[model samples]
Target: MIEHRRIAHSLVWSTVALGALALTGCATTDKGGSSNLPTPDAYAELRDARGADRGRVDIFRDSSGLRLEVVARGFGPGTYGMHVHAVGQCAAPDFSSAGPHWNPTGAQHGRDNPMGAHHGDLPNLVVESGMIGRATLHMVGSRLTGEGGLLDADGAAFVIHAGPDDMRTDPAGNSGGRVACGVIATPAG
Candidate 1:
């Protein structure tokens, strides 16, 4: 039973969600460098677009890292193959049943392989039908959130494939079909 929540903002949405979670959780700036992060309008605004198969994925973290913003719609335009697997249970028809890819640094599977894979091997999402298929993935060498995350001791899930992550496949991105999914909870910043 892993449950953590904390999104109640009031101080101007908590100073714009803590300045977009300190520019996507990269907050270390004291006149250092690499600090222009701020983009989390709860996945960058894009209200329910008439159930074009539904969409709205917003996962956040601060100190400058981990950000997702899949705001799909009707799923139609191009590219899909997304990643972030490793259980959260989204069973039913075809959520690929949600179960693999959140490789907590076991590392391998593309990004130029070395064997050890799975860090939600992301790279493929372009939807644009009625207009909504947006993606803003950025987990490069991630820790996920405010305290070293892959969901900090038990938490993670976000899959949406069906094709396009041929990032040198091994555990995923043979990208054929998994359709849609989401369960990256544990943020309340």
Candidate 2:
């Protein structure tokens, strides 16, 4: 009888340990449907021309596509054009150092263009009374890693323009001057 009691106790403890391990495995896979991809592969810290912290952008990779989460503040209330520029530099005031819009496939400038749009053209961002806004954008032709990734070679940048993107013009959608900029890079582990 003593030996039987000891075996039963050991069985109960083993069952409890297995249950705990299963629960932990489920918790780690709760990232929507991205069970196979890394949560956030890259990040960008955005700033105004004065070099003050505006907000940040996080890039995530999943089986469906690439996801970009942009959060920003401290601008005047209005709609602004935003895009990924070709270069990584974010010189103050004009931000010309960031170069033109990212166009890896050599596509045209706007989403409304018949020839096709540039890889960097994103939706317009609207700021409310407190000058704050956040948006999540998804893309099928881009990724945060390898080959034509946003962090490739010359790198890329997020840029905010003074005017709205007309969605049909060439070169830059006549978005006017760049108001804010941020360079995209892989976050340090």
How does each model score on TM-score?
A: 0.27, 0.76
Model 1 TM-score, 2 decimals: 0.27
**Number of backbone-clashing residue pairs for each candidate, in the order shown:** 19, 0
lDDT of each: 0.61, 0.83
- Residue range 91-176, candidate 2, lDDT tens digits: 89888999999878888988899987878999898888788888898766787657777778889999989888999889899888
> Cα deviation in Å at residue 158, candidate 2?
0.7
State each model's C-alpha RMSD to the native: 17.8, 8.5
Candidate 2 has an lDDT of 0.83
* Native-structure RMSD, model 1: 17.8
Worst 10 residues of 1 by lDDT: 43-52
lDDT of 1 by residue, 93-120 (tens): 5655457777766777775576644667
* Model 2 regions lying over 4 Å from their true place: 1-39
Clashing pairs in 2: none
